[model samples]
Target: MQVYKAFFKIIQKNRGQILIYLVVFMVLALLLTNTYNPPQDTDFSKVKVNIAFINNDSDSQLVAGLKTYLDENANLVDLPDDTQKLQDALFFREVEYILRVPAGFTEAMLSGQNVQLEKTTVPDSTSNVYMDLLINKYLNTAQTYTTYLPGLSQADLTQYLARDLAEQSEVTLISNGSHSANAEKSGYYFNYLSYSMFAILILGVSSVMLVFNDTDLKRRNLCSPIRSATINFQMILGNLSFAILTWLVLISASFVMYGSFMFTPPGMLLLLNSFVFTLAALSISYLIGNLVKSRGAMSAVANVFALGTSFISGVFVPQELLGDNVLTIASFTPTYWYIKANNEIAAAVSFNADTLQSIFTSMVLVLAFGVAVLAVTLVLIKQRRVEA
Candidate 1:
């Protein structure tokens, strides 16, 4: 009990450092959430492109009908027949397309002869292509009508060509039963939590363990009536208590920030995933404490492990942008599995066997890493004792 109390006292002394990390990360999470603003749904019917039309064709129903179609679909900007004004309009992006209907275009269409409409625009203009396709569709239908119905008058054909035949499609978006909208925000919070927890556990537990590893304290403990096994058990209890307390503080803060949403199926999976990662971090800290003899070295180890792993394992940057080689290397770390599982959870529609299986597989892999590190730490500790 005394040893456990002493261990907690060391952690309490370092509470300021732990609190600083927590506050900074929380502020960062809030800032990130605010920085990303999604645009509202837009009404496509209101969209109009500015276009310049030059009609050199003589008076005919077909030419008049084509001009009316262009006016209705686009904003027709009247410009003088000067090359300079037309070039300026295109350069300034005031008009997306300049369409010229050559002389005899109406006659060629009436006589079933091949005719071409000339168009000019700024290079690589997307709106220009859309306008071109619209013109082609209109003219193609007019050509078909003239070819098949020779008996119909030109006025009748023009009226038929001007009719709107576009089908209105209704789009309905469905949610996949997952909290995908909030998933990125949740991931940011938990990723930073893992980083802060790793550093805190290493610095807190290792510092206390160092005190116990002191030569005089070790000799005195050996001389005491208490068994070495009992002393080791107390140390383990202290470390475990500190780790659980740290995990709870972080988890609770997440809940307070996100509210009841944290209890949702996906959110619950995130919590469990983080818990498994915390265990892996604890084992890593234990290994580092056993190997490192000084507080300075332990602090250095904490920074390298925590920051390096976070950056490489998609905590700082998204996994989608990371290179294949980087992900392959990160696969060896527990943070990789934690982030990967979070991604899978965010994509899952329901709590099905497939989703659960993948998540459990990641958890198992994380536990395996912890167990392996702990086994090596135990062997190292036993070897050191034998040498002493």
Candidate 2:
């Protein structure tokens, strides 16, 4: 019927604008999903330890070798061998470990005597982890030198250990709890921002049109044979069709850029779950159109409200950084639900109490917002008709 015809007319009239918006969103989705360099270099700057040597010649080859090893691979801050300074720095949390080279260290090693060097470390400290790994690697390299020439000469063993230590590599752990392979926080950030920002733009404009036409032409259609309920239903169908159309375009772009990660249950679930926000958008648009007399005013109000919601809900940034108070307020916005759903999808393999609760809460809030806004729209429509 007439409602369907009116819907088609709107589509035909606005096809160019709609197509342009869809294209822009598609390009943005591709850009966001595409793999790119992380915000920082991949190299890990490891913490360095302090060493105080007694009767140790700083110019000795072994000392030079160890110094080079620390310089090239760690964040070494060289300090004098004063025991007072060393102990004070360590106690004050300035240093995690200290190395002590006793007198006759070089003579013992050169004379074939077994000399054990002392490396002091804090009982429990963050730097201890990296220090432990480095110490183990150095020890293993030392043992390997003992196997050289059936019995390694002290000088030869020192040389071999120094060479191995100089070339030792540092390891860093960047994880989000679960074993997600090479996933990074930046990829997740891009995905959610691209989806959410574009979704808001598309729905915001479409919602205005859907609401604006009702105020302008709905009364004329009311006098026709078609019932108001049927007209409203058809309008809903048209808006949903456009919403889904935009969604599919975005999904395709994401898939091309992100590969299989975009199709997993968590990822696709996020994309589909965002449709609830579209309903919320429609309802809000209805409220605005009913309250305002001009399309300009409606657009201004919608854009401002949409941006405000986007900011408060952490669509521009992750909600975790916003602290509890901002995050609590964010929970009431449909945009927050959409972004939360995306985060859950990114960490799908490690589903747990917090993420599951977030998913459930977001869906419930979106449904509630949609319902509340629709009820308001209905009230506005009734009052407008009564006044007329």
Per-residue lDDT of model 1, residues 280-385, tens digit only: 8889999888778887797788889888998899888888999999999999999898888887886666778888999889988998999999999999889988
Any residue pairs clashing in model 1, and if so which? none
lDDT of 2 by residue, 356-381 (tens): 78777776787788799779878877
Superposed Cα RMSD, model 1: 3.4
RMSD values for the candidates in order, in angstroms, are 3.4, 9.1
Alpha-carbon runs more than 4 Å astray in model 2: 15-24, 35-50, 54-219, 352-357
TM-scores, all candidates, are 0.84, 0.61
Model 1, poorest ten-residue lDDT window?
A: 38-47
